[model samples]
Target: MTFRTRFAPSPTGPLHLGHAYSALIAAQEARAHGGEFLLRIEDIDQSRSRTHWEDQIYDDLAWLGLSWPRPVMRQSERTKAYARAVAQLTDAGLTYPCICRRADIEAAAGAPQEGVPQFGPDGRIYPGTCRARVFPESQDHAIRLNMAKAVEGLTELSFVEKGALFAGAHRLDAARLVETIGDIILVRKGMAASYHLAVVVDDAEQGITQVTRGADLWEATQIHVLLQRLLGLSTPDYHHHDLIRDDAGKRLAKRDDARAIATYRADGATPEDVIEMVGLTP
Candidate 1:
């Protein structure tokens, strides 16, 4: 298969140094392998997604000397696809509706059983309060994959990792997934789909052979792999690279406007300079 990768970013904020590093790394990898590098707009959360920020993403990436084929794949326009995937999972009895809010989960997890994990990849591993509840027709709720049900009969679950950390073949533990990850949200309330569900479906549709991103997302790869198996999608190779950090050694975020690519450009920094700042070759 032809090698393919992508740089997917939410247009809710500015593309910072970390974003530059990831995009450059993906584009560089594609070039080195004589493959294709794609850009995806992860704007599923339309409430925060803005046209101006999306425009700035293109501007900033172009200013950094990176280019990709257009028109780009925007998540907002792919809700029907996400809904279909959700419907498939639901029909297979691998999904359930969840009406529990954040506060409710916290209260339920307050008194945990001994040796039970308090957190997982999806943050505060779902308490499964709504796992046995029937799907309410008129009530608003999110959808969650039943981890235990999803992993049934699925042995030999693994993926290739080409990143710096954990660079090798890794197998997923089914029991660990149930205990730690729990039933993660596939579709969030008031949103078309959660990141986990959307990304897996999008990667398959885009024919992405490899997924490149920051190391912070390493833990979440297992979830994606599981979803791929459940959805009968192909699992891609993964490259989780180092993250760009601030002076204090913390990873850069969209909120860190000082480290934004646009800020550097405004301060008269060139594309080469920005690339060098992120420890990449021009």
Candidate 2:
């Protein structure tokens, strides 16, 4: 492996401390191992993604003493590729239209099971309300992967994890994926594809040999595994690193503008301050 890694962030808002830590660690890892470090703009959500935020991302990373090659990858320009992946799954009988609303899926997932919340990588496990419906393209519906069928179609699956706690390789069970992940969104209404699908496709296309991200995405790897298998893509080594939290122990979010890298710079905080804040330096 070439130890390739990336720091992909959606340009919906300014880069926060959490984003900085992940980016810094990924770049450091690639450098330490003599590998390539890539930056990707996950700006597929055109409705929310802003060019100003993208510009801030560059400034933030540069201030943190990170550099990358020219021509960074942007998800917005790769819709056609994502569409082809979606079409493959749909034609292979592994995907169906999902027209259920969030409220509807929540109600169904919690139907008659109080106090036992159903959750997936993105929060609630979709109840698969429209998994069986073969709706017309004229109807407004998102495409969802048929987890049950998709898992059965694949043989034994596994992935590598480099996190300190769960370090080493990990094996994926087909039955657990169907049970825990349920059916996940592939393509949204009038969009290219969901984050799960786009990421799975993008990583392979980018030749990313190592995925260094937050531990919050560990569970989502199961869903990505299914997509990788379905699309015949190569799986990469995953390094789910620790998350950066505030004094109150809450994880940082894009809405936490006070913790934004740009804000810190304006407040007289140096790059060393950020490195120290994230405990990446002594």
Candidate 3:
């Protein structure tokens, strides 16, 4: 089978070293296997996405000697697709409307000492405040996925990574995905769908065979897998690679303009130097 992968970057900010590292790794992996590499603009957060940043993405990738197979796929242009997926899940009785705000969920669930909320990978685990509420005449609130029924009887969840399969079951720690993430926000209040829903639809639409990115999103794999099963879409393999950090070991951020690809390039850094900086030798 032909291998297919994608480098999906949100255009909310400039492309930093972490972004470069991830994109290069995906590109190299595809080339190494004589597979296909695709570029996807995950600009769903319309509030922050900017045309300037998008242009920079193209410029930075080209400067790094990376090329994608087709015209870039932009998520902002795919809202309708995500809406359809959300509707499908809702029709299947796998999603519900959530009225709770972030603060409300945190207060309801009580504050945990470490990490984010246990439900879903996002950590802002919905406390299911509206789970028992009768479906309001109108859904003015965000929608959440009803994972309780969706994952029933599935004791083990596994996916392929780095030519091997890794399995995780039930909850990540003390919080059960079903109860903690019960009725996750599939749609944000006025928004049609959440990132989890849109991304799953996009991945399947793009025919992506494997997903490679930072390990920080490891928890989100479960959310994607559950969505795929619910939508009857094929689940792709996942490889959560290590994150690029600074001398202090903090994960790279868009605010770290000092590490932006454009900044490094202006400083006379070669593409090979960028690869070396990110720990990708090729």
Candidate 4:
């Protein structure tokens, strides 16, 4: 099969230097392999995702000289696809309704046991309060995956990145793969789809042969891979690149507008400079 990769960005805020780096790398890699580079707008967060931000994504990416293969895909318009996948998972007994609130989890897991609360790829770890409860037919709650049972029939799970900074091809951590990510949420309380479900379904629908994103999402790949297996979808090879961090070593966020692409453009910084800022060759 021909090589295909995508740079999926959530259009909730302005594109930042970090976004530039990832897009450039993905575009360059696709070009290098004579592959197709696609762009996907992860606008699942309807509350925060705005038309302005979506337009900014197109403008910034074009300004940075990063071209997409075809017309971009917006996740907000693909609710029905995500809903279908969720229904399939629910039918397979892989998903359960989670009624536990954030406060309940925090109160249940008082005080840090060992240093800070152990966090995996999907942010803070869930204490699994609603794991045992049998969700009623009329129960209105978020859906959670039965990760423990899901990974039982599976033997080995791994992926490879053709190019990487530290390890060219990284291996998946087996022990932490199952333990750290236990019963992750698939659908939010009122939201139609969750990140895990949406991402996997979108990736499959887009025929993403490989995924190139920040290393911070490395752990989350396991969840996606697991979902692929559960849904009988093909898993793509993954490349988790080093994240762009600020001087304080925190990952660059949308709140840091100073690093926004618009700011850089206004400050007379060229697209090449934006690529260089991400430690990539312009």
Candidate 5:
């Protein structure tokens, strides 16, 4: 199989050093292996995703001396595909409508009898208050995967981590996924699909053979692997690298205007200079 990878950026804000690092790493990996590198616009959050940002993404990537295959995949346009996946999950009895909101789930998860509050991949673990309930058709609610039920007959899981430090086919810590990443959301009531659902679907559709990203998303890989299994999609090998930090010892954010790629370029920084800034150049 061709070792394909992507530099998917959510067109919500300006691209920062962190974004550049991830994109360059993925592009380099694809080039090193004589594979394809694609660019995906993850504009699932329509409210925050702007046309200006999308335009800026193209400008910045081109300025960085990178290019991808034509007809870039945008998550917003792939709602129909995501909807079909959700429908399949609904048919398999692995999903249930979640009526509990963030506050409600947090309160329930933090209840005294609920034991030491365990946080999952999505931050706090969902308390599953609506797991067993049968809500009316008119009820607006998110759809959550039943973690325990989802892994019912599955055997022990393992995935390849091709990062610098965590390389090889590593066995999954099932206990941690069970305890920390329980009942993840697939689709919100008003939204077409959540990140977990849409990303897995997009990766599979794009034939992403290798997923290169930051280590911050390591735990999220567990959920992605599970979804790939459940959906019968090919699981891609992952490369989670170290994150680029700012002077404050914090991860770079899009909101950090000073660190935005556009700002640097406006200040007469070249593509090679930016690459060096992110330590991508030797």
Candidate 6:
């Protein structure tokens, strides 16, 4: 199969130094391996997604001297596809509708127990209060994966990591997943699909052979792998690179306008300068 990778960005804010580094890295790796680099617009959150911000993403990436094929994939247009995947999982009894709000989850979890993880990649691991509840037809609700059911009968789960720090074969403990990352959200209350579900389905549809992103997301890889297996989809190799942080050591976020690519470009910085700033060759 031809090597393929993608740089998927949410068009809710400016592209900062971190975004530049990720996009450049993926593009560079694609060239090095004679593969194809693709761009994806993760605009699933329509409330925050803006046309101006989406246009800026294109301008910023192009200004950095990176190129991808036209008619790029956008998450906004893939709701039907996401819905179909959710239906398949639901039909297999691996999913349930949840009406628990953040406050509800916190209250249900109560105090943190000894040796029990309270937080996970999906944030405050779900308490499974609604796991046994039937889907309410008239009430708005989110969809959650039935973690125990999803991992049933699985002997072992593992994935290959080609990152700089943790480069090796990694295995996941099924029992641990049930304790920590319990019943992650497959679809949010008002969204078509949550990041976990949409990403897994999108990667499979794009035929992405490799996934390149920041190391901060390493913890979430196991979730994606499990989803791939449950959906009968292919799991791509992953490259989790280091993140770009500010002087204070905090990772750059969209709010860091000073580190935004547009800011650097306006201050007379060239594409080569931006590339070098991210520790990449021009």
How badly does each model clash, as a count of residue pairs?
0, 0, 3, 0, 1, 0
**Candidate 2: residue 168 lDDT (0-100):** 85
Ranking by TM-score: 6, 1, 5, 2, 4, 3
TM-score of each: 0.98, 0.95, 0.89, 0.91, 0.96, 0.98
Q: After TM-score superposition, what is the CA distance of residue 244 in candidate 1 from its true location, in Å?
A: 0.8
Please give, for residues 1-282, the per-residue lDDT of candidate 6 as tens digits: 999999999999999999999999999889989999999999999999999999999999988888999899999999999999999999999998899989999999898889889999999999889888876578999999999999999866888988787899898889988988999999998999999999999999999999999999999999999999999998899999999999999999999999999999999999999999999889
* lDDT of candidate model 4 versus the reference: 0.83
3 or 4, which is superior by lDDT? 4
Ranking by lDDT: 1, 6, 5, 2, 4, 3
Q: Please give, for residues 56-139, the per-residue lDDT of candidate 2 as tens digits.
A: 999999999999987999999999999999889889888888888887876776554664437768567787788767767788
Q: Candidate 2: give the clashing pairs.
A: none
lDDT for each residue of candidate 4 in 155-188, tens digit (9 for 90 to 100): 6666665545544554555456556867788898
Query: Each candidate's lDDT (Cα)?
Result: 0.94, 0.87, 0.79, 0.83, 0.89, 0.93
lDDT of 3: 0.79
Q: Is candidate 4 or candidate 6 better by lDDT?
A: 6
Off by over 4 Å in 1: 112-114
In candidate 3, how many Å is residue 15 off?
Answer: 0.7
What digit string (tens of lDDT, one per residue) describes model 5 on residues 1-282?
Answer: 888999999999999989999999999999999999999999998988999999999999999999999999999999999999988888998998888888888678654455554776677788779888987968888899998888877876778999986787877665666677888899977788999999999999999999999988888988999899889898899999999998889998889989999999999999999999999883
Highest-scoring model, lDDT: 1
Estimate, for each residue in 40-63, the C-alpha lDDT of model 3 and write its tens digit.
Answer: 998888888899999999999999
Window of ten residues with lowest summed lDDT in model 5: 109-118
